[model samples]
Target: MGNDGHIAHLTGPRRPRALSPLREHLRDTFWFAPTAGLLGAVLLWWAASAVDLEIVALLQRERAYGAVRELMSIAEDAKTIVTTISAAMMTFIGVVFSISLVAVQMAGGQLTPRVVRIFVRSRITKITLTVFLATFLFSLLVLTSYESESSAREVTSVPVVQSLMTLALVGLSLVLFIAYVSSTLRLMQVGPVVDRIARETLRMLARQAPGSEDGGDGAGVRAPETGWMAHEGRAGVVRDVHVARLVRVARRQGVVLRLIPRIGDFVMPGTPVLAVHGGTPPRRALLRYTVSVGVERTFHQDLGLGLRQLSDIALRALSPAVNDPTTAVQCLDRVVQILAAVVHRPLGTVHHRDRRGAVRLTQRVPGWADLVDLGLTEVRAASVHSPQVTRRLLAGIDDLLLLAPEERREPLVRHRELLLQAVEQAVPEAADRRFASHPDRQGIG
Candidate 1:
């Protein structure tokens, strides 16, 4: 539906769709496994106890096992033990979680709010949560088997084994508690967080590795004059695009599709999100599923969003309240390293094609100039009086100029001019301005 409540028509043939296994797994990393894994673990342990205990009961019936009777009595005692411990574990989990939350809050306040997602989406935190929940559920289920009435029907032979297993799990939880403390402390620090973000970004770039992937960098490319436009009906960030699936859909429909938004871009409802050229458009029926929209941007696909996270840290460090130029310089160091890898690589800009050499997708990537600006735009503005930040910012620009191709160097040069202008206005002393404007990683000033 259009914004004012008018009918919209889409032209295309309906076709069946399938997902590749890799993309399916990629979707799971966002929010599914953390919660699902916990529930699944509980079900697993319940099933485990049921199957193992039944087999032990069969062995006892075959052999006249007096030891089995003694074991059952111990298991009855173990039931009370597990139940009491489980409740305590619940309280323990609560305290650990509160401490972790406090650490996360500090990271957000000091680093950047956007990076708060990193802590929220952390694998260690997720796994710890799952284990704690699973342990509690396991204990509750085990205790139920020892109910006064159910004890009569319950197998006597397996009590000792079950008790031992629960005891071992308790021990494991203790170990996890120790590790969780260590992990939380690491998260609260600035060095580890920034380094982690940079490494992930570098890893993502290494996978793409220049000419190995099709990133819209085709020459002499222009959108076809005539085509249908598809408007997205929902508002959210473009979390992931099924590029392979989109290519397949375009191949089936025999059309050239142009995507309007890249990963991490926010899409407003009733906005033109894609274009179809030279054939029938696949329309919302096919397009909606191929594009995954969500409330938060993720690092799963958007390399630029990683840059945004890093830049946010730098900008925050430069804030008046923080006034920590050393931290800003550390962030700038990473920003330059990331840019050197990206600006020289193949940026998907113009076209992507199917196996038959037909144009299946088209896109526009952030140009070198725009990308440089993204890295420095805010920090530069805030560095008006901070000579340390200005020097590091300008030095990073120079490093990028040397690393980037000559054509891409234009933006770095322009940024240099602007940084000098800033230095001139803020630092009245010519010596200070000259030192800050110099292209050394550390300013003599």
Candidate 2:
């Protein structure tokens, strides 16, 4: 993807949700779960102990039936003790849970998955200890309630109810928290994969620029479609230019390649800055076939490919003659100027088939052969008049003109024919009309 497309994907749109108090409570109860559970157990034991013996079982024990009955009666009488112990359990649970929660919040809630798993595992040990403690407390409470009969029985249920509610809330919260942590980690992994591939693809597209030129050495300029082979590999246009400047020019751009050079040491392209390694092969394959195909088929092949071909041919033609990179760059500039002139000229004629039809360029320029001859003559004269411009134009041409020395002219003609064909496809009506008017189209040139 391009830079714009990547940014758009990452920061897409907001999502909607439904509000609920249960969900809100669960979210807030990360630390309260264990505490609530313990408190609830304690309160349940107290309530059962505080009830009358006649209300539970007549002789709810063994050989000490009289004693047990009497103790049970006393426990029922002292309901205040049961209520007080239950309230204390609830308060203890609440304070401990609150403190744990506050500590977590203060630590910025950056608990890792491993840490959470450890806590969950430790819960088993914690639960075992709490159960033992609850059993002992229950036994002690029963004994005390039996001994303390004749005191007033207090009626209270707020602690028991609150503790039960807390248990439910905390359980739900932990489940949600685990899910959130898992999802967040997954997203973090996915984000970098997307970004890396996207940036790399964008760089490739930029390197495959349509209108850009790479000037070489002195020679007559040719067009881009002259069958020049790709050698330097591909990179983004901006990145390529930046690499060139950083390596060849002084390192003013901070291109980020780590290799340092001696005063006279030679520099190379793949010396770290241009090379990327160990990318996920599948992602690379997908991008190569799908994304690159779109760029070439839609943009490069239709609009830019022909131009690039011509530029390559022109560069090869001039490379051997020009020694200095600056001179070569100048040569490419001149050729681009010449090509620019032809680009502006209508490659085809536009006519309205119907009033409602859109106007478009057509390939049948009436006297296309004559126009091309005139263009060549004009550029040749201009080249002679302006030596610096000519040199630059020739330099760009030389970079691409080295494919086959003897077959240069033939390839050049073929390249122009391809452009003409492309222009015809771009505007078929003009071509059809021209063919109908002059079927042979033989004497025009």
Q: Identify the leading candidate in terms of lDDT.
A: 1
What lDDT does model 1 reach?
Answer: 0.68
Per-residue lDDT of model 2, residues 1-445, tens digit only: 1211111111223312212223322333334454664576568656654444333343333344555545435445444544555455445545544654454343222221212222222343245335433533553444443332232232211122223333443444445445534543432342322222233323332332121112121111221211111113343221111122222211222111111221112234332222111121122221121111110111111222222322332333234453223322322343343343333232222111111221110111212233233323233332322233343333333333343244233433543344334434443477443332231111111
TM-scores, each model vs. reference: 0.85, 0.19
Top-scoring candidate (TM-score): 1
In angstroms, give how far residue 144 of model 1 lies from its true place.
Answer: 0.9
What lDDT score is found at residue 258 in candidate 1?
A: 73
Model 2, poorest ten-residue lDDT window? 1-10
Determine which window of 10 residues in candidate 1 has minimal summed lDDT. Answer: 1-10
Off by over 4 Å in 1: 1-31, 147-157, 207-226, 348-350, 442-445
